[model samples]
Target: MRVLFVAAELAPFAKVGGLADVAAGLPPALARLGLDVRVAIPKYRAIGERAQDFASAGTFPVTMGGKDLTCSVSQGIIPASDVPIYFLGHDPYFDRRGIYGEQNEEYPDSLARFAFLSRAALGLGPALGWLPDVIHANDWHTALAPVYLRAGAVDLMSRSVLTIHNLAYQGWFPIDQAAAVGLNEAGRKLVASGRQLNLLRGGIQAADWITTVSPTYAEEILTRGEGLEDALQARRDSLTGILNGIDTSVWDPSTDPHLWAPYSSTDLAGKVVNKRALQEALGLAPTAAPLLGMVSRLAEQKGFDLLLVAFERMMAFGIQFVLLGEGDARYASFFRDAEQRYPGRVRALIEFSEPWAHRIEAGADIFLMPSRFEPAGLNQLYSLRYGAVPVVHATGGLKDTIRECDPVHDRGNGFLFAEYTAEAMLEAVGRAIRLWRTDPEAWRKLVARGMAEDHSWNRPARQYCAVYERVVAR
Candidate 1:
């Protein structure tokens, strides 16, 4: 089966989040599973000028605002994979320093930018004679792919699947701009009083199947829109959630080149070397203290406020803390103050470094991910692979991925706190610290068990292939 993936970002090219990771990893896994899969994304500044293995396909004319606009198409082979990647390059929209907007705000021309991309993707299927069996679209950026396929002019034989990585970002455009993007009369009628063009809603309404990242998240979107219009509830039968999986090769601690020492379930004594190295890197005193580390976007939704509250109390307990990320100003300032307050105990890195992130996963004794609502986090899975015990709030993928330790049996992966309160977070941290300080045998078991579990994309990829087969069969 031939599958075409339409997404805004792909790994090592233009990645701002997990969506890019999925776009790059899942398709390659599917290709290895004997399906022909290809990726299509807009050419942004981060992708650089010359694309590897990229060859010009001449200019294709696209109409916007009743005027013709020609976009250049370039094709490249995805590194270490048999799948092909197609890029739609145009100067006006995507030639910027960042993938999204400069600040937290969305780009003003985002609607027109991605609208062209979606239309171009559908238009290319016939032009290039590569008619896919299914077109899988991700997020609001590529939400118009389904709508484009449903257009009468496009003789699209492919069924479309829409995956909502996060329901928070629905592409809202002016009602006047709807016609420019090929929104039909019926679609326009469904708009609310604002008459805004809700691209995600249209895609969810138009697609043959709709999926989110987790089962809990899928259920959560029903009553709570999360920017997904009430139409989410209307299309209840079609919507489903499939939890995400990590690429084990990228996250494995046993062979990770970034680690100070390589260690696995069998030989976990080397984990201490990584821990010491992490302590040194964070400017903490090289003591045998338990370290709690976090690598996430510093935003309110990630429960940073609660983390601050917990940390204020946690500082009295004498545990080391390290953080690495770049996000909102308020959180950054808060962490800055904390860094000054506890110089040797707390360290915060305001950047996104992949290698350093890997080191954190390999080294930290405890990983904290207290997200208010996480769709499907990859870090907790990565932490498990590294034998770094996770102390996470029981919500979304955290609940799905991390198994809570049975105090009686002593046979689980990590610690799980049910409530999203600061007290609950501190309690969970205290539990992790107690385990580290007191229970040697249980700590060894937790580390061993966490390392033994599988969180690879292999299983999830097969499940996706099954979903593809089912959708095609229908």
Candidate 2:
């Protein structure tokens, strides 16, 4: 079966968050199952080589705002896979520095930009004479793909599947702009929310199937849908929450070139070497304290505020802390100040480095994820593979993936805090620290248990294929 993936970001090309990783990981896994899968994304300026390496697949015209505009198409194969990736070029709209916006300010023309992407993605298939049986749209950026499909914007009759990565970001625009994007009169009437047009709602209503990143997240959004809970409630039967999987090759500690020393669940001596290296490199004293680390976008949703409050109490435990991420100016400034307040105890790298991320996962004794609400976190999964021993808030995928450590049996993988509070977080960390300082054998068993578990895309890929087959049958 031929399936087309419409997304705004693709890993190693254009990326902003976990969605990019999902876009890059899932397609290749699906292709291995003998399914003909193709991905389509906008040709942002950030996509290096300027399309010089891609094969020009000619051009197609997308009529928007009653105007027929031509769009250039370039095609290339995903690295190390047979899956084809199509790049849709519209220089005036997508040729910008940042993918979404700058300094927490989204591009004013985001609606028009992504609207063109949805229309262009639909047009890309017929232009290349390789129409797909199903079109899988991701997030609000490509949410309009389902709306366009239902409106018959293209010649092909493709089933549509919309995946809501995070419901917090529903593309809201002035209802007046709907006509410019060619939102049909019927769709406009249904998706209009007071004087606003919600792009995600439009897709949720139009798509044949809807999915969220995790099973727990799928259930949580029903009542806490930001503003569209009612809309989601109306279509509960169609929604499914599929847990996301990580790219084991990229996150594997045994072969990770980013690590100071390679280690596995079998021999954990290299973990100690990497941990000492991490402490020395980050300017922390090489003490016997348990090194705590986190690598996440420093946003409110990621529980940065809670971490700030919890950090003061956590310091009393004599644990070293390290953070690697870049987001929210406020959070960045606080962490920068933290380095001064606790010299040799705290290190916050205000940048996003893939190699550093891998190294941190391999080295840190305990990985912290205090997210208030997470859809499906990849870091926690990566931490498990690297034997970082995650101490995450028990919500969403974290609740589903992480099990509370059973000291009696030493069976469970990680620690979890049920409540979303600073004290709750500290208590969970305290449990892990106690395990580390007292019972070293049990700690090793817990870490090894997490490492032995499978979090690869092989299972998620098959789950997605089943969804695709169901939609096609309908």
Candidate 3:
């Protein structure tokens, strides 16, 4: 089976979030299963700077908005793997400093930019004489690929699969711009809702199969709708929810290069060294207080507002806090003020740094995630692998991945709370703290169990291959 992945970002080359990580990791895992898998992404400015060797494969013209835009295709390989990676190079659309935008705001021309990308991705296969059996499109950025294919823009035997990474971003635009995306009469009708063009909705309506990152997320979206729930419900029979898996090779604490000292489930002495090093780096006095780490965008969806509400109360438990992420000016300012208020106990770095992220995962004793509505969170998975007990709200992937610490039965990996409230989060944190301070043996067992679990891509890859086979069989 030949599979072509259409995505906007690929990790280690161009990344804005977990979508890039999935794009980079999934194809290779699929390749190991004896399936021919290839990935295609835009040749953004960052990708050119990071990816090493690339020779021009060919060029093609994409007709959009009554103009023919020339697109260059560059051939390369995914780092550490032999899977072929094709870059669609169009300077005006892709050669920018930021992948999507500079600040929090999205680029105004994103519709046109990604519309060209969807068209170019479909055209590239024939240009290279490597047509795929399945074209898996990801997120709102590449949602239009299925739409274009449904509109007969490309004559291929490929079946289209649309993966909804996040339902919040539906890519709604003025209906007048429908033609700009090369939408035909049927395509326009499929995407039109009132006076807007809903790209994600169109993909759900057009694609052979629809999938979300996790089963719980898939169910939550249908219930909450986020606006497109009705559309999702209408296509319920076709949708499947497969839980995402992390690249264990990149996240294994025993062999991680970014750690101060390597440690495993057996010997946790190195974890102690890492904790002290992290405290020194963050300018907090090294103490026995449990360190709680958070790496997330400071946004309402991530429940940063709840963290802000519970900050003072949470600090009263005699714990050290370290956060590394940047989003929302209000949350940034609040966390910074928190550092000022509690000089030796609180530290916040309002930026995204790879090394710091790995350090927090390896060093911190507990990780916090209190999302209001998470589709599928990656940090909690990373925290589990690093033996940093995750205290998360019971929703979506967090619900699926984490089980409440049950000392009586010697089961459950981390802490979980059902209510999305600050008090509930504090209660969960308190339980983790109690375990850390009182029952050292039980805490060790919990940490060991979390590390022993398999969160790699092997299982998820096989599930995806099954989806591809089902789609082709249709």
lDDT of 2 by residue, 1-474 (tens): 999999999888988899999999999999999999999999888773566788988888999878888888888887778889998988888888889987778999999999999999888888888889999999999988888778765566999999999999999999999889887787686568899999998888889999999999999999999988988999899899999998888888889999899999999999999999999999999898999999999899998889889888998999999999998998999889989999999999999999999989988999999999999999999999999999999989899899999979767889999999999999999999999999999999998999999999999899999899999998
Residue by residue across 90-200, what tens digits does model 3's lDDT show?
999888998989877788999999989888888888888889899999987888899888877667778999999989888888999988778889888778888998889
Arrange candidates by lDDT, highest first: which order? 2, 3, 1
TM per candidate comes to 0.96, 0.98, 0.98
For candidate 1, report its TM-score: 0.96
The alpha-carbon lDDT assigned to residue 325 of candidate 3 equals 92
lDDT of 1 at 446: 89
Candidate 3, pairs of clashing residues: none
RMSD in Å for all candidates: 1.8, 1.1, 1.0
**Residue 394 deviation, candidate 1, in Å?**
1.2
Residue 459 alpha-carbon offset, candidate 3, angstroms:
0.6
Alpha carbon RMSD to native, model 1: 1.8
